[model samples]
Target: IISPDSVRLENGTSLCSGRLEVKSNQSTQTWSSVCQQDFDQQDAEVVCRELGCGAPSVLQGVLYGDVEPPMRTTEFQCGGHESALLDCRSSGSDRTTCSPGKPVGLTCSEPVRLVGGASRCAGTLEVKHNGEWRPVVYSDWTLKTSAAACRELDCGSAVSVGEREESSYRSVWRIRSDCVESGSALRECAAPDFSFSSSSSFLNLTCSGKPSPCWDNLQL
Candidate 1:
């Protein structure tokens, strides 16, 4: 049987967005890409849930890369409530290998949103990871770094950034600077659990566009 948590996304900008790959442990540890044609909307939903990401937002064939093998030809029949792909019922391969289609490439909605601000584009930043939302804490949060979140929101360019000082130490997701600048989605760049006490800071951003994705390119 494939490991329940063994499914992963590759080649896209973030963990929640990429080509689908599943690993089997019953035999030699090998990763197999799922053919796009065999994966349906419900199958995609299970993959997103298994990755602890938000709902499925985008699915297209070969968007991340070329058709890859060895492909898992089992057609997944999911009801959309299962927590993992392995728990869903599946059918054996109609073909022994991938013949006509590319592997599945998916982009789940970023589990990212702004809160307590003037609009969806402006507010204190929070990201959902591993099923929980937390403020992000990082050392290098310049406009360049902060702008990544704005672009992810499709909320145009970042207009301004502010900091908030809080009380005692609380857990936060520490982001890696290199990861954000690399154009990865903010939630995907989270490093590890972190805590900050006195004089700790949080980011509140304001974007130029109100509620829609306006800017095609992020302003430096």
Candidate 2:
């Protein structure tokens, strides 16, 4: 069985996000890359669960840095409900034609989490983008946008919106005012524009209730 301790995220800014790697039996005991495979979101779900993360939000290829020699390859056949990666059927294999220059990366739902608020459903909004966490700015930020973000985090309806000043400065803003629309998922929004000045203003939101599994199933 592949113990949870044997799996880890490498080169990511957070524990629940980064390139997936597994401890190997190779001579150097080096970590083996878990990218460049034919696995889909179902397989990624298993990886996140094994890492003790909430859920798989993003499954990307070659975003993380590359691996060195002795990289390992495997095919995961997960049913999308396994608790651990080893609980799924996996087969060892040589590198395939789809091998990526870097490695596969994953971002769990926790990356876009709430903070500095009264409850898990309310807080100063922060999002993990390009391996860094940045506050969402208040410029042109609207109620619809806030609702979209809250929905992205699996939080219920957006109940309120406010702003706060940051003690430290951040050069980048993860979301622009018009980036999100009503009834749209945050991932479907455009990438942030870093050209705008780092406004000291940050956005805060309060969500109405618990996560709705139906809404949470919506894809980017």
Candidate 3:
């Protein structure tokens, strides 16, 4: 089965933007220019949506860098509404036609951002997963956890943490309180085995303007 986590952009400045790549045969692989050249706004839309990004903001020739030889090539006939790239009609054996150049690159509207709050930097936390915006339920939501999120969003440092009842938000992922202390990336700290559940509880954060540097970028 193809998991939502299997699709991602690598070698870019952020998780929401990078060189497009897909996982296959228990390994991750990059697509050649054949895939890039074939991609249009429609294909970019599906890829961005599947990665839980807001929308396709930018789709063009390689912005990250070049992929070396032995690259995987595929042709996608996406209807522009598929949930995953693999769901599109694809064929992978046409490597000979691919041009030798940088691979495809994409950028989403906002891969991670704050919402239901006063500003872009403060609000109930929501992260995109599986082409949906889901809440983050920290069993022990704390300053450290909030800090991690703030760092991820480039929203400075966490000053305080609070809770609010927001019944409309449902969470498909959770972060164990203990996982925060290890300084893992917010996405990395996420517990993979949990399923989605509807809940009203959410963490509210206040962060400092001088954000710290952290890394843990995933498409979903």
lDDT of 2 by residue, 3-83 (tens): 266677777745677788877664677677775555678887777767655577667766667666445666778898887
Best by lDDT: 1
Q: Tell me which of candidates 1 and 3 scores higher on TM-score.
A: 1
Estimate the lDDT of model 3.
0.64
lDDT of 3 at 110: 55
Clashing pairs in 2: none
**Local accuracy by lDDT, each model:** 0.74, 0.66, 0.64
Q: Using TM-score as the measure, what is the rank order of every candidate, best first? A: 1, 3, 2
TM-score of the candidate numbered 1?
0.81
Cα miss at 29, model 1 (Å)? 2.1
* TM-score (all chains, Cα) for each model: 0.81, 0.49, 0.63
Output the TM-score of candidate 2: 0.49
Ranking under lDDT, best-scoring first?
1, 2, 3
Expressed as tens digits, the lDDT of each residue in 105-151 for candidate 1 is 88777787878897888887777765777776536677887777778
Expressed as tens digits, the lDDT of each residue in 35-121 for candidate 3 is 466566767778777766667766766576776654556667888888777788875555545455647788765555567776777
